[model samples]
Target: MRASESDTWLAKMISPQSEDESEDDILYNDRKFSWSAGYPHWEIFGGGTRVVATDALTSSSLFSLTEAVAEIIKREKVTHAVLIQPVIDILMKEQIAIKLKKIVILGTVGFRSVLDCVGKICDELVNMYGMVEFGTIAAGSYRVNDVNTYKHKVLSVKPLPGVELKVTDDNGHLVPVGDRGLIQVRSQKRFTGYLNHASRWVDQLVRTGWLNSSDGGYITTDGFMVIEGRINGLMDVFGLKVYPFQVENAIKGMKAISNAVVIPIREKETKFCVPCAAVVYHPGSENTTQNIQEYIREEFAFTKENPIMASVYVPQVVVKFKTFPQTSNGKPDRHGIAAEVKRQIDPKKYECIE
Candidate 1:
């Protein structure tokens, strides 16, 4: 909106929207607090009140996310801020870094990956943004983070006081410490089942009394958690297991790559799924499919003697992309990227055997 339209827009939008508004009235595409209306989830922590904010109302939210946070709150300063589901796309992280530096303890959700995105953006968050402690946080549609618990990995979160969470393997056994598995939760606050789809509730949500969260992560010795990614995205190639994050992480670590996604593309004739990559490289990067393949070979190929090198799950093809498509949740949409990659690959010309 223009400067003249500011007042007109302000008159229409009620900040921190009223608790009295109807549920249907409160939720929209841009608004974030759909679960609890517009009340910013507040916690009495670190002195005063710690306000949690997110890109609920994208246009309105980004204003608070990047600029005028303290002014919008009408406070001298915002001591603590928790961000969730806001910085989903990769490029937006730079925007957030440059703009969001006022709050002291800025807990955000930018880098849900294993690496702390603060490194990617540089330490300027402290000098420029008034940030002392900043890390990715764990908060989502179904649950809130343990108000008292804070950690480094953004996805590492503890369920609320009344909730019981379990990390389990494929056989339903509890994963040993440091090993990744599915996160399952049981709580009175949790939804019992989805309406009309009772069986889907069993398949997707309810696993006995516990709800299968589908999120993948590992618990630490001290009980802090580190989420990896979705367990359902696992791809199999020639009977070997391949994980998207594992391949993507390896690719991103390469010097030439700026961003990368390893997506599973199923071979139409053989029906065997092969891992392919969509890469975004630094400007003027001399990256080629052969070199990218070599990087993955060096990173993940088990050994020549182990047969994993021959059966390696590295990208068979590396297609260049200007940017990644955002998922509904605003994260990088690997499935969407895979669909685009499939269109470019000719099945008759290219082998899909990995």
Candidate 2:
């Protein structure tokens, strides 16, 4: 595609401009768009650096996409990269030979193994957290002075300048430090309102002017923030609550597993939700569904006093996949995975482990 045509196509994919928007509204949105696209990081990428898009231009499998990026980095002699966690994992697994000076991680929290792999190759590794509604909320770079200290601060992110973060319970009360709750943000750079969606924006904003992030997380005593998962993605098992990321994190902890996404599947008879894991095992791994289920059972095993807690956390069913479906942006498609799991596995076949 021609340069102008390709730029237009990518712009449309990011956010389609509308002819109906007023001049002021268009100007406001343009500013917000630049912020979300990492405008603040331009200084790091300055000084006549040649930048290339990491995303694949055409539809391709995960492996092919990895190969494509490695080729671009090598051919362009790129020194820096900003990538999502999944892309980092693929590059590490393939052991691609593209050297870099700095890497900025976006989209999701970096897995410990992935971070370690990148730390060895890159001089600097930065983790950034934000949403499209707001832009670049919090970001922190690993201390290059000590590579051993990087893993400990993988989840610790500092709020960006002029941005404030707080965790609140369901009743809108502030939760104690280290207690998981809904994460909220107040920032001067936040978008005023969605295009023609003023009511939606009002609903998300609280009387105190904080925007509800709809993300479940906690803050440390030292004021570092740790995001657990999306609050809306929580599963209700009987009466207990289960976070999908908690289960997925436990499953991925196994050496055999490479990646996992835990989703809720509602029981046909009772209509109650139960966690089901869709896992992608490492190549040459001989682990089966039963083995993964057993691993999780042991990971969350409880004593006689609190045996019931184990059931709430453990996934009842496990399904293996060669690769997960990806969206346009190359992130794992959670909705597509949930739909595929329901179509392939029968909920009645597996019984909850109690």
User: lDDT per prediction?
Assistant: 0.48, 0.65
User: TM-score of model 2 relative to the true fold?
Assistant: 0.77
| Stretches of model 1 off by over 4 angstroms after superposition | 1-155, 200-207, 255-258, 266-272, 282-286, 351-354
lDDT of 1 at 153: 36
* Tens digit of per-residue lDDT, candidate 1, span 218-250: 787777555555555677877777667667666
Top-TM-score structure, candidate number: 2
Question: TM-score for every candidate vs. truth?
Answer: 0.58, 0.77
- Residue 159 CA error for candidate 1 (Å)? 3.7
> Candidate 2: minimum summed lDDT over ten consecutive residues — where?
1-10
Q: What lDDT score goes with residue 190 in model 2?
A: 39
Kindly list the per-residue Cα lDDT of model 2 for residues 219-273, writing each as its tens digit. Answer: 8877788776566577788788777777877787776777789887766676667
